[model samples]
Target chain A: MAITSDLRNVPLIGQAIQRLCSLAALSDIESHQIALCVVEAVNNAIVHAYDREAQHEVQVIFAQYSDRLIVQICDAGHAMDPKHLAPQTASPLDFDPCCLERIPERGLGLAIIRTTMDEVAYTTSHGKNILTLTRFLKSCQPGSARPEE
Target chain B: MQLDQRKAGDALIVTPLEDRLDARVATDFKERMIELIASGNTIIVLDLSKVEFIDSSGLGAIVSSLKRMGGRGELVVCGLRETTMTLFKLTRMDRVFQVFDSEQQAVSALSGNKG
Candidate 1:
């Protein structure tokens, strides 16, 4: 799916992703997690890469494997900082729960993607930044979306 | 984003009428929340019953509202969908906000604190 980098168009992408995840027989919660991760990836691309400019193009590619699901968000805008693709150890969620001031109000998109997906990778080539998110299937239903046992 | 706000004793309940709370409305939501807090609403019960999806941006708005309170008041949550609850748990916000099963319970809890 391709979008015009408008933040308002993001929720539809999440719904589409959830529907595709359903084809793989993912649980509602798992699907929600994957969809959210993809949404965050796209949001980051739009907000950071394109600077939230609505005219820019942001494309999302979804592929299902026998044991995992892969999503790739491709954008021709500015290349994202590779550090965001790295597995984050320190999280915004780690702050003191008692101190409201200590809690972070932003910078959680990367952490959510890192925690939900099994692996996240980033590569930039030919002016396109591709962020790949992978989530291994827990148990694929024996059907068209996966290999039958 | 439309919010249904009402008062119950000393607590103010704010419910987002929209099903999804993503980046599109996070800023607006945060602004509205800050305005409400500035208007001297001490205890806020964010009723998310109508909201089905909440991304980091939306969650951040709520956390920002809590910070706006600045320890001078209270902020709580209620009526979280299962997936929404997962997001809270993933972010460890479940530890930060007192969550109740119903709006009544949340209001009661806040009232109890005041009493």
Candidate 2:
């Protein structure tokens, strides 16, 4: 399913993500996490990839396998460097709330996507910025805490 | 997004009458908070008992509102669900803002501190 790069249409995408994950037999918590990750991905495409330009289209595709689910968000916008998609080295444990100079205001969308999804891959193909997020259903038990290790 | 605003002792308690605080309503929430703060309601307690889901944008807005308050004002939140609490913890925002279990408890804590 494809959606415009508009924040207003995000709820509809979220609803579709939830329904698709649920149909794949994922638990409520698992479905919710996946949906949130998708939202982050879509938001990033709109804000970063397309620069919040109007008339741009963001395509979303959901594929469910026996053991995993894959969600791909594609946008025909500015290319994102693959190196930038790597997770940041900064751990939340190292974050100091009082250190106003060090606190990061932006990039939480990428952080949330990286933290929630099992595997996140980003690339630009044929002038399309593609972000693929995969979740292994069997490996991650429903309602289980985040794998800190 | 309707905000239920009322006075509790010396502080203002504002609750969002919505189930999810995501990208759609984040800006509205932040704007409303700024308006309240501008109206001299510095000591504020945000009641989130009815909110079940909050995205990063919503969290960012709340943090922005806190920054807007600066040192002269206080912005405390209460009645967060486990998922919402987890977001704050993961983002290390739990240390930035004081969170309570109940609205009354938050009001008393802030009121007591002021008194």
TM-score of chain B of each: 0.98, 0.97
Give a tens-digit lDDT track for model 1, residues B41-97: 988999999999999999999999998898889899999999999999999999999
Q: Global lDDT for candidate 2? A: 0.81
Q: Tell me the interface RMSD of model 1, in angstroms.
A: 0.7
Screening candidate 1 with a backbone cut-off below 3 angstroms (N, C-alpha, C), the clashing residue pairs are none
RMSD of each: 2.7, 5.0
Candidate 2 deviant stretches above 4 angstroms: A87-94, A100-102, A139-149
Lowest lDDT 10-mer window, candidate 1 chain A? A140-149
How far in Å is the alpha carbon of A82 misplaced in model 1? 1.1
In model 1, how large is the Cα lDDT of residue B28? 96
Tell me model 1's lDDT, rounded to 2 decimals: 0.88
lDDT of 2 by residue, A40-128 (tens): 88887787788877678988888776567889888998877766566665543456788644455556766777777889898877898
- Residues A94-133, candidate 1: write the lDDT tens digits: 7888776788788999888888899889999999999989
- The true-versus-predicted C-alpha distance at residue B37 of model 1, in Å, is 0.6
Query: Which candidate number maximizes DockQ?
Result: 1
